[model samples]
Target chain A: MLRRFGLVCVFVSFATLPAHAESVRITQDIEARTITLNGAEIVIDRIQDSENRLEGDFARTSRPCPPFCITPMTVAPGVVTLGELEVMDFLDASVAAGEGLLLDSRLPEFFAKGTIPGAINLPFATLDPANPYRDEILKALGATLTGSDWDFSEARQLAIFCNGPWCDQAPLAIRYLLQSGYPAEKLSYYRGGMQVWLQLGLSTHTPSGG
Target chain B: MSATARVTTTLNAPPDYLGGNMFLASSRRLPEISMLRALAIASLFAGITVALVLFKADPGAPPAAEGANVTRSSAGFDNLAITPTAAVPQVAQSVPQAGPRIQDQGHVASLPAVAADVDLQAMTRGVLAELGVTPPAPPPTDTGADDPLHAMSMAALSGLRKMTGQPDPAQSPSAFQTLIAQALQAGQSDAYIDALLNEAAGSGRITVPSALVTAEGRVDTHVILSTIVAQAAIASGQDIGAAKVSSSGRIQPGQQQVYTVSAGDSLGSIALRFYGDMSRYNTIFDANRTVLSSPDSLRVGQRLVIPTI
Candidate 1:
């Protein structure tokens, strides 16, 4: 009896609340509240705490234009732009199934502090052509190598993000991938990123130190 | 150095144009001296190359293999050396040169993962073969082992595969495997678990019966979790390890959950158990304000309202 109930309990976690308590939903129709990202089940929904203040690096309102410029609707040609719900869906499906990756394009230091639960830290600088090990990173994304040229026929679906909509790091990383011959069809851009993620009170997990 | 010195000496003199005023002569004759010197050195180098070409024996004369492939130019990337060459096929003129890349003014565009499976090393050598190096091929250099490029390429695939928590397909699913999967699903990292196990071993709480790494070079999470569960079972001292341990974090159909406080019970620990997050202790405190006096005060056998977060 416990085993069968345990299996059902594994699915999601938004059942009990008082009459006055408001339920946070990702979408009106759908609520796969807890999702498997990377390898763990994380509460992707809003934190139930109403008093939780937006604090730390994510709380800051503005940054300078040159480095932290606003990104476009689409990151690169043929690269699909996704919102928070789409990101959650991708995390629950493709990423969970190992057919896709949710990449956090921030530097390791920024990523280490906290990030979207399922995102792996693939720094934007590492994707640059200047990096000698760039081919290795592309291969990690499931691109097969035939000598020095990359073969992305079996490349994983990659959805990338940096700090937020104003950050160009993810866009730059996307450009680097294209330079290395990565197909734009397999790429996705999560434009809102961490800033919006915090605004919605979404849970963030600190990745283990490398 | 010897050849350059000889070339410079041979071009030391100047025509009788500028008068032998030291400053005027020095400035006027400098360009003429360098140009003449360059010509002399070029001839010397040309003679040496002619000698090498004439005398160098044919070792690996194989060019018929790459006669079919086209040599095209790839632009923008600096380290990548895909140069265009002539003399491969006659229809090569039909292949157009690549155009310039679109520059992002606001620096707001992205790139993609192209699936070009062309052999770059073979193509590089093919370019050489097209460049009249059909007589002798140089020795091959292998840059495989300890290569940072290779490591970065495989990190995502390996890291994601491990994250999946699914064992290799060859292995049959077991109960212990299920236990390990649950532990990974709990969200703490392998390094964290390793530290926990190390601490437990140091404290003499659990026996380190086996190595954490398996013979296949995979981290044996199976061994680690099994030890932890067994230790917890022994420490708890109950039937099947404890009095039916289950998470209170599960979604309930009811609006509230009531739990009688047990031994060693605290609001923080209860909050962690009920919500899967210890920091939400105030949620419980605020919910059960009528019953509990403060965050720290919790009496035995008190019914606490565990609110869903």
Candidate 2:
């Protein structure tokens, strides 16, 4: 009976082995089709390979200067730069628990195409002090007005990114937000953004009504 | 192997009713003649059965089945069967017999009458009438455009006065000299005003004095020249759609200019300030297509390249 049981164990082990020997192995243990974000299941998967020969703008090798230049590593003093795994962790742990927000600071044109899951577009210019709509935007971000003074006690932590490290839209947004009294410790910068996210074969989804 | 060869082999080979024992043990023959007769009859039946099996198993049978579908009811198949050797020559003969001579005799004389019956103009007019669309009227010709002074009106002079921020007068100017005096009084240079008058005159507006039209070397002011540049742009057939006056009034014609987008700014408004026509915003959009994907969304502090048209 013991011998039979051993034989069955060997057979099961052989059966469970993968078909391809050279397939890549991921370091992170993320195997689920969707992840929890803000108490909802957000799907995480790479873009499918298109049959057509044409490529998209994010897939391009280069873009114009002034707007698409690479940014510095440190945006603010206490703000920490994040990678894909760290960003995902932020979304899964902080954002899902209602302690954080993910901001895609690109203009609506780029944001409308596709973005990282769980990201909301708050264009960089909207946070400018000179912007006429700054107060309205600040109010919408959960800032409360008390006797002509703004309070940021209940404001969630923000994770901002744009087209990638090369794009300044998000950095400008981070600077503006920092100037507007958002705590630097509460801001996480996803510097890799959509470019590196797509390069690494990560998933993205278009937001509703984007 | 060929179908005929396979059939022949099945006929000659002995059937295996008793397995290989029939051939091997045949030398130990049966003693009675009746036994030999029975064996001979059995062998004959077996040979016929084997032959039918071989024929069914033949590979060449499928092509014959396909040919059956093709010639199931051909018109000339029966006739071809009666004279098989002449079939190819007869088919070849039928083709050229329906040659060019037959086509010419049948079709040539009938084509011109068909062509003559079609009237393209009448057909087009009939189609137009059926659609209930009338032909557009011809544009009117103006013979008085050569006389620039004849087109002067108080309304145009008043419009110019309003553009320069001057109040409408109780009695507006009806002639070119009075209008020029009002423009000069509103802080416009003589040369700049003279250029605008020439542009208006060229567009069949009031004629200016010959001396003003021929004058040169007047002092240039950035403020006055830029305003005249904008106004002359409109008179020179540009549609300067509602654009606010720029804070820095400098005209940089035929040169590259960079404009930072401000709040509530659009390609139309920007084009109106620089090129003096909202429709020419495409010039800005085309120049900035490398950075901007659409002309509708302009971010604040986004610098756009403006190419002069």
Candidate 3:
């Protein structure tokens, strides 16, 4: 009798236990450029052609995931990896050739002092957000922008660098180029940035005024 | 009446009399009485057995053999007494043993557990001290004009020297001054020269400008002139020259690119669309300067000028 009673108690206890909680889901639509979370649409404002501060904010908050969590859908052209030594060689060759444009994404103060020889200062802050000139600039130089109009596509051979590996500016700049329509094959990311250049024996320039 | 009295007398007679009396009395009366007595005894025995079985069958019955007798000569007596005595001692010993034993067990269990709780702040402080981290003394508050341009110039010269594998160029102010004179003679922008100086200072290849030195060893120049020059150059790039007149004289890129203002759009949106970025929205304002007083006053439809890149 006691054994039978114990069996009944066990069954009752098992029947009364609670269930587990579920996780929330967030989704994005590339064609419509919309995002949905938990069955509700989310509207994102302040997205520009040059730099999307909204996207940057979104990337920062999407923790435990890649910083820029775009969907798997291939909407924009991909990025190119320029080997470290090749980038260094390019810088040396550019100086010798006096033909390449050294673009710095650092603050204006950093650029004013010494930068790569013949480099131009086009701070990320200056790019046109609404109708980004990444395409136009590349086009002016006889280059092509890669993907969609909203993307940042610039020339393939262009070398983009920021402060260093620790800096996200260059990556964002590269992303901007890829989105704008620059061919993935032509672009090279110089991961070793100004710090590396400065560490190595390289040229820099400063404007003359006080 | 005579017959009933005789029968009663016979029934009441002693067992010996019944056995020894007439044949009917001996055979029938005594035998029948004995049979009734046997039946009564059997019924009583059966009732006792039923009661015992019922009690044993009860679920709440006392444990079997709980008070069972043991042989007096057995070792049980000694065991019982010794067990109580031994138990008393164990209880006394357990009081002290429990505290330390439990504590030791807890210590053993928690030692590894507590290891991971190292205080990061304390660790950082210790490491910083080991690394010779000292608070930097506050900068001098009194100096001449803090022209960022001059700083840039110094920085550029220092950078140039470092690049060329030469010794620090700012070691001799005269050489630096001569170099500046030569660059200026060669028609370098004054802003460019200042930037070079600032860059030199930034790179730690030059001392603070002599102009910054004041009486009592205090330096106070805080003017960020380099920043101003950079801003001016950026502004110049943003400014639209003569509106590029295509053969049709229409705005080259178009009056406005179509845009669906998203949730985050503002007047800055329209301006950035028409202009290259937000900074050149002022140029759009200048183009429509007659109508829109501020860039903020823009609707989804309002056509605006996009300045040349």
Candidate 4:
């Protein structure tokens, strides 16, 4: 009986030892058009052809997972113009790029007086905080996060302008877009705003009632 | 032969008593020895079981009191007293032994009240400092109320008068001179008045002339009158050349200089029309103070002094 009990104890200890180790699998199959992680897949459909190339450039700077698996993407440098760019340059680029312009001034009276033609007014106040677009902003813009209502996915290039040099509204709006993952190259700032236009003796049209 | 037979018979008869028989007898006793050994083992096992039962039944039984007094004297009583020594040795080694005893004993009696008194004094000083009042020295007295020379100074008195909208008597001449000069120099044509006032006011040096009055207690106003004539001439769309007074002391080009004041004509507007800047409107206000209670209350056809630069 003693010999039998000793044999049983040894068998139980051997059985308790681990049989297999756990691991994660990442697969990028060309046929799938998706990034598969442990059999779960996330699709990439709306990524543009040019943007795809840009993303590839971005991936060079980003850290890749071990065994050539997950590729973390970052914004490619040399896109956004730092400091100040001329308003005329911005306007010409915006028109050439076919991107819609957004004027962020909130004062309806001032907007009625005179503003950039074909520009839509979306005040920065209306943005919802829980939106993923805002979270993307913290990643792209770094520590400078002055939130605004400019969608990165909808518009390819967004030009924001306000009163003039004294105006901080457009810069703050641009910061929001840049932070929100809108490509800095696609963002334009019209620094010589309405005041400069008026001062240069350019034609200005007021709203019908104004 | 009989002795040999006797020995044989005795040997045959006593075979049971022989040493070989004794050896066989000892061999037969082995089973008995084994039984006795088993019985002794069984007895030891029973003793062990009994001892275990007693131990389990009364595990915490106290020691017997044999030689209790000797044990107490030797170690037990002394050890009981010395056990707390381990706890106290560190405190004794670390603390200063003197002076604190007196302070500890007196702490409740005198220390707290004295500390509270000092704190209250400091707080009072802070409050006084915040209130812009100097704190009183020891044995506090009300110094502010008792100060005899705390009355307002001449400069402060003048500031108070200005606040009250009453001009200081000493400064009356300068004020009067400035008012008269402004009234005399204000003009009528918008562009000219604006340009003139802009130049004059920007220059930062306006000369105030001495007051001159007429016999009937009216201000003798050669300067004011000429300024008005010149501005009116400009406003009437007639260029009155060089603004000269004839030898008879009458303004030349009288018809061209006189302006029929119209509706929507404010002293400032009129000044701007003639002086080019509205700041020279004060000239009109000073000139017409006797008739025009305020610049805003001007009547349509009221004659005004159109000051000249």
Candidate 5:
């Protein structure tokens, strides 16, 4: 009788093995799919629809040049332009790991429409040296104010993005951050922005009641 | 030796099926066969578990890049800079692929079983439904961000804002800016927006954006969302949404609006559509002066920034 029971148990175990290992992850326990701010939770993932395409103003390509010109592959020396997958890795390794921030360098109104998951809108305008609170923003980014000079030793890894490759708001911010002595290695530019992110149907967050 | 002979005798008496020594076959062979079967099952589970662990492993994940020199002494903070750490080779920034080209959503199949959201879980169904994942728990109240200082600064500032009833600012931020400041304090993700748009698109309940076609030649879902929300605001008699959507594509009325030049669109025509007067073509011409030689530089499908008259 015991043998029969053991045989039945073995069969049940064999039948149940289907590889649903949820706890297993490539990175930290955050699992690279979610971000939480204050008390709000933001789940990050690609749009389930493989057929999704870029739409709206981002899709329109005929903006006049000079201001809307295609940005160079690299914004400045030492700074790297990150693609979507690398951005995901950065989010996992740095942002989710709490050593980095995903900054949206566009204006507030554009950010209000919708933005990549886990992004905080810091608007390109504020990164300018002229802004009085710019120092406070830097302090928020992990730059310790030592007397008059800013110390960026422990500054947060900033992965900044704007509308798309055509829009230089992100590049502009990167230049300004460098001018303000933010380390080049600490910043990453997501060149695709809404143009590529939306085209691929990645998840986006819109602030509730905005 | 005698035990071996007895097993041979039992084998030689394989007339068990023929009703000769059936008991012998059951007595000796049963335990060995069952034991081997149990071993095989255990091996199977072990093999599968190892394969799964390897499959989900982040093989592409490189070690976290450390700064080359920890002692970052700028012109200003020469005195207080910390001592330098051992210089490490900084990793070169890798160029990302041009195409995120609609590949299989294979990664979605591996979504951590820990995440909890009834709606998202339902959406995640069918990809790996057979692999029994636990039902998602309730959304977490807190997942402490890794950047303790960033979180702390935000907390401290917002707390102070709450106490003083005003942010200690030389320039007061706009209402939109205030929303942004408050947004960072909370926790969240935006899959809800995508799901909501899908629901709205599926039911034919939402209006489409006036832009005939987007860069991808598909309808703009986000713009559609913006238009709907803006219309809802207008229905409350805000008199908004008439003039311009910024270059980034919010259906807003403000100083800067983007007008896509149609086939017959001269600067004057675009000016007429945006403003009440036709002579205000120069408003657009002047705003885009960096690209336009004269007012005649307009081309079909070119996006012109129409500034307010």
Candidate 6:
């Protein structure tokens, strides 16, 4: 009787196993189309593609050297060097909160193709000392003109980027900003820029949407 | 007795000449004189040939390979007599010409080393001023000229108009309505249109079918904006004592070109059209950071900056 009872128990256990088996889940890959930074959503998609291929200066394998060589790992002494993720975080903390600006330091041509979310187009050439429009750009960045000198007491924090590591535009703008008395500590360098951002499958939006 | 002996000896010597010794001496002396005279004449001819050759070999003379070869071979034979004629032409051509004339030739070669950097602003300013179009004031040294948007504001335009003796004018209801419709069709938010309209109303007043407006009959938000800008330019021009004016400042090449995105337009396609290379899409993207957050997000009719390459 005990043996028979034990066999009956095993049979019951076996019958019950199918119920639990149905409830057990199988792991699957998850692809996210959007990432929320702070309260804002960043769509991760390639900005410009031709026949399913993306285009632009950043698409080039090699750019002319001397002017467009890859920048150093650090831009300046006190400026923070940031990767794509760090840039997104900064975008959330600074741009979303309206505490700082995300500046696209390339020419308007480069900036038009696509850029990080929350970035404003401020061409590097516009801030170049030789450009007649430099002072106007400085004023737009919230610099106060005291005689011929600029005062940056009310300047917002700036996170600047250009084409990518190979682009010198952002570095030029940063150096000019520093020379113009912008606090280096308040500046963040998004060195990866649009190249790295797109490489990692991040979302981008057009200017019209903003 | 010695004198008689000497006279007899002289008479004997004369008879000895009859033995043909005198004839032998004359013959030897005549050959010596003739050989020396021939040598002297040959040296004079050789010197004359050398001087003539040198005079013909002037640098200003046109290149004549055959003539040069002849002169060179002549000199070689006169100096070293062993030089072959066949080698002289090659040697003459191979030798590089050297002289002040050669140096002068280099300077005379075409092409200016340093290009004149033309100041387009100064050039245009002169022409505009001569035409009674007062160019915009030179940028102030003080900070007042620093804010670019300041001069574009409604208050600034009104102030300029007041200074120019232009009274507040009425607007063309039809043109104004057309602007509103176009702005709405362009997908501008109502709030944005309202604000823009209010701003435009406050700035410069213009009427349709007036001589003050540009003849561009297309009534759109662009026309509306341009009308106000024109009014501002005219007012400012009057303030500066100009007889006529259309715009304030010249559009610089460094100023970004605005390209309207069309249907089926991608950054790559737009780049290929504007830059002649699809790969330069990044340039377009980088220029429009203010409007584009993504390369894929280009909208029809969206204005994009096509930056100068």
Best by DockQ: 1
Model 3, runs deviating above 4 Å: A1-78, A82-84, A92-99, A131-136, A143-156, A201-203, A207-210, B1-309
**TM-score for every candidate vs. truth?**
0.40, 0.36, 0.26, 0.20, 0.36, 0.36
lDDT per residue as tens, model 4, B71-132? 12222112111111121222111111111111112111211111101111222233223322
Better of 3 and 6 by TM-score: 6
Give a tens-digit lDDT track for model 3, residues B1-309.
322332333334323232222223223323433333334334434443554566578856433222111111222121111111112222222211122211111111111111111111122222222222321111111122223322332343343333323343223223233334333233332223333433343343434322221111111111111111112222223111111111122233323433332221233323323331222333454456455443333333345444443
lDDT of residue B100 for candidate 3 = 20
Q: How would the docking of model 6 be graded?
A: incorrect
lDDT of 4 at A32: 17
Off by over 4 Å in 2: A1-28, A47-54, B1-309
DockQ category of candidate 5: incorrect
Best by TM-score: 1
State how far residue B271 of model 1 sits from its true place (Å): 58
TM-scores of chain A across the candidates, in order, are: 0.84, 0.80, 0.48, 0.42, 0.79, 0.71
Predicted complexes: DockQ each: 0.07, 0.01, 0.01, 0.00, 0.01, 0.01
Q: After superposition, how far is residue B5 of candidate 6 from its true place, in Å?
A: 99
Decide which is better by TM-score, 1 or 4: 1
- Which candidate do you rate higher for DockQ, 2 or 3? 3
**Candidate closest to the true structure, highest lDDT:** 1
Q: What would the per-residue lDDT of candidate 1 be over residues B140-210, giving only the tens digit for each residue?
A: 11223324433343344345446545332113323323333333333233233333333333343433211
Point out the worst 10-residue segment of candidate 2 chain B by lDDT.
Answer: B211-220
Estimate the TM-score for candidate 1.
Answer: 0.40
Give the Cα lDDT of each candidate. 0.50, 0.47, 0.34, 0.34, 0.47, 0.45
Q: In terms of docking quality, how is candidate 1 classified?
A: incorrect
The digit string of per-residue lDDT tens for model 3 on A1-210 reads: 999999999988776642211211112222112223223343322112222122222123334334423222222255444543555455545423433434665556767765554344545443323332232333432343222122223222556666655555666655665555555655556665665554443334464441
> Where does candidate 5 stray beyond 4 Å?
A1-32, A35-41, B1-309
